[model samples]
Target chain A: MKNLRLKAARASLDLSQQALADAVGVSRQTINAIEKGDYNPTIRLCVSICKVLGRSLDELFWEDD
Target chain B: MDWLVRISGVVALVCIGVMVYLIVKMSPDGFRKEQYDERQTLERLKAARAGFYAMLIVALIYLIVTSFAPELGNQSRVWMCVMLFFGIGTFCLYAIFSDAFFSLRQKPWLYLLLIGVNLLTQGFNLVNYFADGGTLRDSVGTNYILVLGMILLLLIIGAALVIKMILDRTERD
Candidate 1:
């Protein structure tokens, strides 16, 4: 459930948290929760986030081994 | 801004007048005491439920409107519209719904509450129109609307009473 990768990808994009949230059609708080690994985003939301961040699914989201 | 304030003033004055009329001239004496006491519980519950339902409707509309306002940085007008909507909305809600004329029970206490709300709501209209004098001249539609509303409500109440009488007769047989 860890999403340190998502946080890293977001930081590298030079996008504000709100910008990412808006691009993904989710709330800033939802993005914040996802970055903190406190919430699991839906598949649709995950795809939206990946598309906005210009990253592949594996690069932005992965379970910790 | 001034119009908003003026409208609020008129609304408040009308509400105050209704309260005064209810306190002074409103009476539940035209109906039988036995029937009024019999349905006291039903009457109170229905009034409370209808009040809550009406307020809930206003609150939902306010929430939807305010959500739009914050996005555009026009929160002031949004607040004004939402506030006024709820204010007048709740008053009319109580005016329209709290009446016993719509009650399923057709009890005498419902009739009393029906009469009380009608008096209060119309009194609000009368007071608002006259207190500002005819010079204000904006309450014409409100007056006609309330008068028509009251008449329709009376008809409903009369129908309920007829139904109650019929039911009571059948039960006695």
Candidate 2:
């Protein structure tokens, strides 16, 4: 769910999923669906999301009980 | 007087039941039209939310009124008239709020049918009033508010449909 929100904030910054995907090299839908919570990204995606969001992996993804 | 309120309550209950049944049977997500734009989808979500809240408000109002005036309507004649008012109010509230809040990609066909059934119900009550020796309490007259309300109600439905059709056609390219 946290990753799902990253793309929305990026979009609000006027960054298209395609552009962000290109910067991070993932599918546009990977960005779109993740932003909508329809899909979950990989560890690589988690790193990219943190990089793009200007945060760390620990801040973005936490283990659930 | 209590009977009148009870009957209206029953009819309202029936309509709510039918609406719930259709809602279950017809998935709200199954809109077949191609999504050409994001606005159409957002509109539908808004309208549906409005309809839901309006219904809840109507139910709460009825519960409070009946709790207070349980004896105000016991006769069939009185209940019929009261329900006529209640039905029209609920129908209009659903249609207008939905229209104002959401631009449906496609207007739910059930809404159009509800409008027709509601109008017909009022018309039937009008005839019933005349046939029953015509008591003022028994008459459900069509007033300017109801006419105006129904017009705005249908107008919004029509507008939503037309916009959807146009958007769908444009998206075909």
Superposition error at B39 for model 2 (Å)? 0.8
Q: Best-fitting candidate, measured by DockQ?
A: 2
B-chain TM-score, candidate 1 = 0.34
| Model 2 Cα shift for residue B4 (angstroms) | 38
True contacts reproduced, candidate 1: 0.00
Clashing pairs in 2: B1-B72, B1-B73, B1-B74, B2-B73, B2-B74, B3-B73, B3-B74, B4-B73, B4-B79, B43-B103
Q: Least accurate stretch of 10 residues (summed lDDT) in model 1 chain B?
A: B31-40
Candidate 1 lDDT, tens digit per residue, A4-58?
7887788898787768866865545457667767666667878888999998887
The TM-scores that each candidate's chain B achieves against the reference are 0.34, 0.33
RMSD value for candidate 1: 24.0
Question: lDDT by residue for model 1 over B1-173, one digit each (tens)?
Answer: 99999999999999999887776555664332222211233435565566566657766766776677655333444343444444444443343332322322244556657766776776677567667663322333444444544544555544555566465454320
TM-score of each: 0.29, 0.28
**What is the alpha-carbon interface RMSD for each candidate?**
26.5, 12.7
